[model samples]
Target chain A: MAAIMAKPSLKTLKCTQCGGAIELRGGHNVRSIVCQYCGSCLDSKDQFKLIHKFLNQKRPFMPLKIGASGKLKGILFTVIGVLQYEEREAGEFFRWLEYLLFSPTHGYVWLCFEDGHWVMMHEVKDLPETQVEIVSPRKTRFKARDKTFKVFENAQAHISYVEGELTWQAKQNEKILYLDAVCPPYMYSIEMRGSEQEFFWGEYISVKDINAGFRIESFEPATVFSCQPFVVSPLFEALSKGALIASVITLVMYFLISSSGTPVMQHHFGNQLFADGETSKEFKVDKPGSLYGITVHTPNLKNAWSFFDVRVVDRDETNKLFTMPTTLSFYDGYEDGEYWSEGDTEVVSYFRIPEAGEFKLAVDGEGGTGEEPAEGFSLSGVNVSIREGVRLGHYTLTWFVLCLLAAAPYFVKYMLFEQSRWHDDEEDDD
Target chain B: MAVMLTCPSCGNQITQITRSPQVLVCPACNTTSFLQNGRLEDVGKSAILTDIPSIFQINRTYRHKDWKFSPVGRVRYDYGDGWWDEWYVRGENGKESWVSVDEGEIAIEVLVQEGLNVPPFEKLSVGGVLMINRQRMTIIEKNRCTMIGAQGELPFKVIPNETYDYVDLLGPKRSSFTIEYQAGGVECYKGVWVDPFEIAEA
Candidate 1:
């Protein structure tokens, strides 16, 4: 339902049906003018004859009134007419407002408001060239004014209401098939009625800009529109780039700072040392204070257990002892006619060398074969190997993990924005 | 040489600005007269046009970019939906052109000479295609406009309330053409759309 109001006449004329003063702003070009006060459609060309009258029509929400002037694209335009169209697709009803704007030199332009989004449109005489893909036949492309647009929507829209002065005689429920194509921030609409086809090109305008142009209050957008472009702030862009660069630099520096560890000590001892209950060895740590790895292997110890206490002393007369307690166990027997082994035969551990000097390593051990080692149990042989300056992986991993954590939120939001833009297409895929 | 004639309706002396024009409307009494057999003939009275907001005026020199012309005559046509004005102007080089003003749209057109094949008006339809002067054009609008009034001196005779059919064709790059069907066969005019903001008083 549409109720219109017009004021301030260029040529003051009275409506024949309702005797209401109708103002004509489009000069002689206006074919029909509706009585704003009485809802009577009057012929503007033939002495304001009564064509028809709208009865009990509800007035829809309109932001701009007829005869209201606003500046658009550097030209002053007046709202002379408005048409409300409703599109019913798949049982869903969609309504939009179209305001016909008039400028003395620029002719006419339409501003369409839908779902709190505004689009400024102009009827284009030049039609776009269309191409259909051989693969994926549902995808249609239109090329116009050097921009390619993909088909976004296809539906039929009907004129629900008409108001004010119009160039042509408009009636209720006039159906027209429309095809919409989008190229981001711009869209092309092809409307067909019988044999007459009209092309309209439109550009998406921000609510802030539209409000400022009309000097009206702000209109909040209900949701993201199809043609609404994703805008990234400069700070966000800089931070994203900086994080990526920092991660790469940290990885490269970690590799440059690490190396393979050098061998420092190797020795083999017989079970006689364990039988004596103690052993000691002096080794030179030639490198500066760094991490060192020590490995102990007992190849010949079978079905036996051993407990040992090891210490590293500075050998500087301070006799500072570093205690390391270790347990080695191995057992094998036939279970269900299959052989199985338990416990480990080798163990490795890491320690930091305090300084580059001589260090004395001492070990004392007890061994057993079955339950009590005091009864009778002995180890065969043992091997000890140590290496200096080994690389640690956690340093590089920590920096990489931190960078990923910092960027996850922004990346997820961007992905969601793109997914929302193609939400209709994704639903079709499902 | 300029020939001065007296208006048959008002008996006022009127001078012919250009020798090619056979019709001239009296500025004083709004009476239309035609030159025939070296004598002025009364052709009834022309309607006094209402003053609408317009950018160009009769007898005023207007400059559009590099081209300068002064409107010597005007004809108003009522084409159902709206009325458009055709200003007959004489260029600075003494040539003539037609400037059409429809609402805010303005175009500078010149008469295309005969010898080019033109299609009949009856077969023309809106959005139809046409080949005129070796250029592919599309028929944008077809209108049967009635000449409501005329003022000043025109190059051709203009009859009051004379209805004629014309088709407007648009070519590539804003090139426009109009084919008018009259009692004497058909006439074509070719031109380009002009920016109204660039037009200034010379």
Candidate 2:
């Protein structure tokens, strides 16, 4: 086994004036000693030198106890801690919170609730005394819940004045302190402070004077708790769910309404040609008056014509509303060299009924017997039914049927081919 | 070349008439000076004076135990006759000094410890040289003089040389003393140096 080496003992030096001993470690030689107890300066030869005397100067290794309480976003919180620090070469106290809070990982977002609204803020920088500027759109007031408690910000935690006793300890002459507290996220802001001007987030209160001997101080509460954690209620959840359902329903209705077809009425009157020499027998439907309840039958002619022209004129020749000319066409019809030997023929066209009136109907050789000649010879058929114009019930029924027909394919796709499992997860989470 | 000494009272140049003269009378001032044995007489009138140039150079490596402890501190003084100098020391516990001569030509150097207490010296005096060891302080006072080695001394002057059987003086404690150099003329002062290592341990 290899032999273990013993560690060298550190040389300890004492100040002549104050009897303070500063231990030098690692066997390093020191040329001077400053008494932390009396602030006296000593040379290597034991000579006393009167250097500059510090007045109202805080000890670099002093521990400060701070107490602060305030309301943030409707929640009241309190903080109590002992801050440890030292003097920089520039004679400024190097405060820890001033540097730690502003670190990228340490920076916090504060949300304060007041006046029925939540105010968010980020800490800017700290100034001396009990003041700090928030990097928010406006300034916010930070006050303790009780008048007896003191609230401070932007002040040096280690050097700020304190009304109570505090204690601290560190490794051998090294400085250390203790802190304890609970604070709300909203009341906090980030700021740059300390001798090096680093950033930190927190409020300041009292600074305790911990003499050189101790390591830990007694813990105490800074302020009373006044608020509880905020929890969202189920009422809000229900209202939000209702709003979402309403929106979805409205969107679906709009899609269905926009995709539905319009109502149309078509009439047939003439013959259809399949082959050049092969012509379909003429077929026609003619009705007098409003023609709302008339039905006409024709011989089954394959390749039959599906178009018809209707004219409605008043007795004084003023062009009656129900006697206006109308054209009709159909979807299922004869192809070239084929005849529409059909049962119920489908018709598609536009028609309008202007007013209540009687109308005469006639078909002759694919053209109606009228002053305006028809292009093809029209079929002959005549019938009459008295009433107003086309029935509103019929138009409504047709629109309903068309809508059902159009939605059939989409319903099948959604149920089988595009079925999603997302709905189940949403339901389970809810 | 022959060595000559100038008489301070009459400003006349004088030379040794013999190597064993007990006393030499100054012809210009009619002053008589006695020599101890054959060695040059220690008249006690000619104080070891350091010029502003030499003092400033030497002080660059001078570290004290107390005042201006940190090298980041600033030092400024006027060496009389409108000659002002400012110095900025860098690094921790280091020593540096500067002088403004005719508004140009500044000299600077770092002070490094050779052993425990001895510090290296550069640009000391006017063409004179100095070398300090941990156990001795040596000075080549002039170009022609033999190197005077003050041996067996402590880094600091706590006890007189005669008290200890085998004692060495280390370097002076930098924090104890504060030195200000001015230049109406040159003057040298001596004082006791102390050892801070002893005082701190005590």
**DockQ by candidate, in order:** 0.13, 0.01
Q: How many residue pairs clash per model?
A: 0, 45
- Model 1 ranges off by over 4 Å: A1-9, A132-139, A232-415, B1-80, B85-101, B104-114, B120-129, B133-136, B144-165, B171-175, B180-187, B191-202
Per-residue lDDT of model 2, residues A75-125, tens digit only: 222222222343343365444321101111112222222212222333322
Model 1, span B159-188: residue lDDT tens: 888899999988876688998898887888
Error of 2 at A53 (Å): 18
The 10 consecutive residues of candidate 1 chain B with the worst lDDT sum are B49-58
What global local distance difference test value does model 1 have? 0.77
- Which candidate comes out best when scored by lDDT? 1
Off by over 4 Å in 2: A1-188, A194-232, A257-260, A263-430, B1-202
Q: Could you tell me every candidate's TM-score relative to the true structure?
A: 0.58, 0.18
Residue A346, candidate 2: Cα error in Å is 30
Q: Taking the tens digit of each residue's C-alpha lDDT, what string does model 2 give over B93-169?
A: 33232221112212232222232322222233332222333222323121211111111101111111111111111
lDDT of each: 0.77, 0.29
RMSD of each: 11.4, 28.6
Please, what are the lDDT tens digits per residue for candidate 1 over residues A294-352? 77788876788887776777665357558777778898999999999999888877788
